[model samples]
Target: MTLSAQTKVGPAGLISDLQSLGLRLEDNEVGVTGRRGGAGPSDHKAVSLAGRTVMIPIATVSACESPFVASRPDANGISEIRRNGVVVSHIEFPRQPRFYDLQTTEGIPYSQIATLHSSDVLATTLLQSCIRYGNRNTSCQFCAIGQSLSAGKTILRKTPEQLAEVAKAAVELDNVKHMVMTTGTPNLTDRGAALLCESAEAVKAVVDLPIQGQCEPPDDDIWFERMKAAGIASLGMHLEAITPEVRARIMPGKAGVVLERYMDAFDAAVAVFGRGQVSTYILAGLGDTPDVILSVSEQLITKGVYPFVVPFVPITGTPLENHPAPTPAFMAQILPQLGAMLKKANLLSHDMKAGCAKCGACSALASYEV
Candidate 1:
């Protein structure tokens, strides 16, 4: 069922609102298995409506159950999104990727190496185990990286050859456009930069896919040039929370890196990868006000960095799992401001060679792009 773009509320606003509130998945048999790399436990599933595809959170502790969203198989595969018994819109879920089925010659499951993200991006946590994950004093309060590994969903480490093979197959089978490779911080200084370089080289040898390598800032700034030379078209150095209070309270282990160090790394990365290609994830509602978040975003934009501010999603099993997600109004207040700033800087997500902001599925800020 096609929806009329002109609704009581604008279509983009509706998407931003739904993503903020989170959709209630009722009897939806088709969905992706929840991954443990990031802040949230809610499954990253593709939701299509209003001529666009957005990845929304579902089947988590924080998901809303009141305004139920169900896929009616009996109704010709249409998804009805309801608000108090009235159908507001019909949505569709994307089918699972083909690459999940095949394995490498050595019997490693392809999915263990990497998984499909949104519709066209392949993302993987290159090293599933983080040095800070087990140490409570050091761990990021919102991280669940070790949870998936404990459940046997992914391998401990992916070899460069294995990652290369998986990348090639995902591209050939699903027509994947870009790939994102993120890793748990191996050590305070290692930060997976060396591993990412090897992985990118192997993947590029077999296929010509644009790749983004995400890691904490490395000790040496020269790693940025090495990453770019190794076929990493984009780089993501995420500061999940901005303020020092929030950082020290939430991600104690990572906070030791200091905010100033990350800014320096951003400048070096932008110089190597160019402006829009360097991005960071500043998660809102992690003890920062809308104004506070916007202020940091402004500073980041001035340094030729793309501040991809995302709303915080509480994941089950993490310390902050019970923490409240940011309200729709707060998101509504901040996203447009950030989007406008991005527009003024001419740092469009569309111009990003490859990365999360370019994918624009996890956050609704892209919906507000002018």
Candidate 2:
């Protein structure tokens, strides 16, 4: 149950509550369009709460049962956030980006090439298809990478030229501050690092926005230097679950790469990207306890890697669609201690050049940094 009105929960607690418990929308609150399904953080909408933009789950199964209901926006586009019919705070959704309405010189819609993440970040999937996604035995059960491609919302492959075109427009038209390019693991040793390099290089040539490249650790460490040289400002190599048992059970194909290899990769990447610039994503509520997550996060921070812990919101059509998300209390147990570790290491998310941790929309961990 949420705290009573007599309790004074600050913005951080409110953000965590909104993220973990999700939010319901009133019938008239449909002016803003929420992303239904996509590659990263699917079934969510970007909302501004207490002046901080965050990705809040709205279309998930958990949201259907949430006590937090958002009223329709007033004339000024502000909505009241009520928990159990009592007003707690206010929120505003980001307007549809101007770049989303434009088309490339060749007439392809810019949105198919790239989309807005948070309020001002441009994000794209370099390759929509992954080698393991087609096979259930090897697939990450929570992934929706193929769903967007299958529904014709995005293209299978985004060429360097197309990405550059959309990126430049996103910067000029929508004031996009940075770009994030993640790809499905291809059938190669570089594991899509090569594609990210090509795409980042192209976008940098056309626009000045910082870029973050995310992919599996390449077979060779040299790729990190190449990525930094190609104008990629930061890197993300996600270890979605820390424990081997959970990793194997949740993402069998990814677990094959092993945590030891990831440790070595983080060390090498940190050398190039510099400390806090290298980060990872650890999904909470995947059966790994907060203690285990914090233990691994400490190791990553010691290696100069930022471990971005996020609550797992089950996406539709995936194997775990009906699975429950972590409760707000669960996140409460993790973020405070993790934030203290980050503070001690001086690995502030604001110090990151460009990445998920920097944007910090999908998780409230950043709010606990204070």
Candidate 3:
């Protein structure tokens, strides 16, 4: 049983509670286009609960429906979210982005280059192709990078020129606050940092939005400095799983990078980006115990890197699509401890200038800290 605590049921808390529980929606295609790539499902849609917008998993593979949370439209462009059988709150879906309508002179849709995430952040995969995505032996078993590109939902490589045009339109038309550019690992030694740096340069020339570039650690540490010089305000080097065994099991190809190397890279990145600006993705419940997650998070905190611990929702079409998300009680047991650690270290997500740690829709850790 969850050891119930007397917690305040405010807006952020309610959104946090719902995202932790997952949300079942009457329609998944209404709001932002859910971008699923090498990351975990990424199938959640944005909802306005109590004035704040959050990304709640509504199109998960394992959870076709959530027991505690569900939403349906009411009259007057409003939505009612029900708990069990009672309506607990009213939520709103953001209107479709205006940038989605326009296209470049080359006839490429603006949205095909990048799209709005949550309510304000702009995000895209600079290179949708990855070296490790071809087969199970090298592939991170959960990656769907090839799925959308294979179906032609997005293009292969978004040139710097195309990205700049899209970024400018997204900012002027949609009021985008920040930009996040993540790329699949290419065969080159620079991984995708070279592409991210070029993309960041292009976007910064066109708009003044803070940008975050996500990639595996580059072959050398200097790439961090080059990336910062290119106008990327923050960096994300993800370690989707915590334990060595879980790393090998869920993502053999990614497991080759090894935790020791990631730690060294984190040290290098923090030195360049300073504290809180360097972050990593730690997908909770891909088989890591709560103890393991908290322990690793502590280590990451010590290095000045933010541990963006998010629940692992099994994406449809991936190998682990049948796997279960962490129990709400598990997240409850962990968030408080992680929150205390972050507070003590002064590594709050808001200190981050740009990217997922600041936007913070996929995870509820930011709300937990408050």
TM-score, per-candidate, Cα-based: 0.94, 0.97, 0.93
Compute the lDDT of residue 76 as modeled in candidate 3.
44
Q: Spell out the clash pairs found in candidate 3.
A: none
lDDT by residue (2-81, candidate 2, tens digit) is: 22222258888888888898999987437766776667878998988877889999888999899999988888778888
Model 2 residue 187 CA deviation (Å) reads 1.8
Two-way TM-score contest, 1 vs 2, winner: 2
- What is the full ranking by TM-score, best candidate first? 2, 1, 3
For lDDT, candidate 2 versus 3, the one ahead is 2
Q: What tens-digit string does per-residue lDDT give for candidate 1 at 1-370?
A: 4544444667777777676667776664544334444422245457677767677766456675535465553435557777566677777767778999999888878977888777799888888888988888999998888877777778889999898889999999999999999998887775899989999999999999999999999999989999999999999999989889999999998999899999999999989999789999988888988998899889999998888888787777788877887877888889988888988889889999898999887787887778
Misplaced by over 4 Å in model 3 are 1-13, 26-41, 68-71
lDDT of 2: 0.90
The residue-by-residue lDDT of candidate 3 on 105-159, one tens digit each, is 9888887788788889888998888888878887887678877777666789999
Worst 10 residues of 2 by lDDT: 1-10
Task: Report the number of the highest-TM-score candidate.
Answer: 2
Give the better candidate number (1 or 3) by TM-score. 1
Candidate 1 Cα outliers beyond 4 Å, as residue runs: 1-6, 28-42, 64-68, 74-76
Model 1, 351: alpha-carbon shift in Å? 0.5
Candidate 3 global CA lDDT score: 0.81
